[model samples]
Target: MPEVPQPVNDNTIKVRQLSHYQFSWVAGEPGQNGTYTLQLVLDQGAWEEVLTLTADDADALQDLLVNTSVVHYDVERRTLLFGVTPAGE
Candidate 1:
């Protein structure tokens, strides 16, 4: 038998830096809900975490990422620049 996925209850992990991410969708059987899996690689590949989200939640996240402005890193300043302005400029 395949292993069942356990629910995450009162557990949290903080990711400071994200190196990579991947999204996966699994179709369910008749009268069942599909699954969305999000894999996150953090801290320059030091750690990896996987999250399972519902269809609504996944769509919300996708919309947020799609609508958000682009982010850039400043090589000279060594900081992340969000949008057109680098905070307090």
Candidate 2:
């Protein structure tokens, strides 16, 4: 009998929600390259890099923010929520 080769499989990338700017807006963790980006929807949607955070910045932001449905940035709070996910997604 001839030996058979096993099929190869690709790794699945799981997307976890990191932060929510609003019910209709949210953001995810930066990829391996340390760059945060957003993808828009349209006939030909595109991905845009909105911000780049250092290790310190990421730690600060993570500690200061939480998931919410109100997308606002106040001088008093000194926190900014950039819209990434589309409405009702």
Candidate 3:
């Protein structure tokens, strides 16, 4: 499923996976100081983000989700970058 942009107020945000390939990314609110999280996913199926930034840094996010077929996702953001292809034939 496509990753939805989660919220980060104090420290971190939890990425909810809607499918097998739910790639996620995140950054601080626009002009909201500066704090960023490093996104990583493993084969073991684990997603986590850490607060390694302050409210003074600008951080944008980008993710690549590989789905089994056509995964559906809904996010507050209107636009996003997705790299996908048809599932196995």
Give the alpha carbon lDDT tens digit for every residue of 1-89 in model 1: 97745663223333234456678999999999889987756556655667688988678766754555553333334333334555889
lDDT of each: 0.59, 0.37, 0.35
Model 3 worst lDDT run, 10 consecutive residues: 55-64
lDDT-best of 1 and 2: 1
Candidates arranged by TM-score, highest first = 1, 2, 3
Best prediction by lDDT? 1
Per-residue lDDT of candidate 2, residues 1-89 (tens digit): 97645452221211223323211223545654444322212112221113456556655555555444433332233335444567799
In every candidate, how many clashes are there? 0, 2, 7
Model 2, residue 3: displacement in angstroms? 80
Each prediction's TM-score versus the true structure: 0.53, 0.27, 0.21
Clash pairs for candidate 2: 22-69, 23-69
lDDT of 3 by residue, 6-68 (tens): 764323422233333222235548876444443333223443323243323222332233323
As for candidate 1, its clashing pairs are none
Residue 19, candidate 2: alpha-carbon lDDT? 29
- Ten contiguous residues minimizing lDDT sum, candidate 2: 40-49
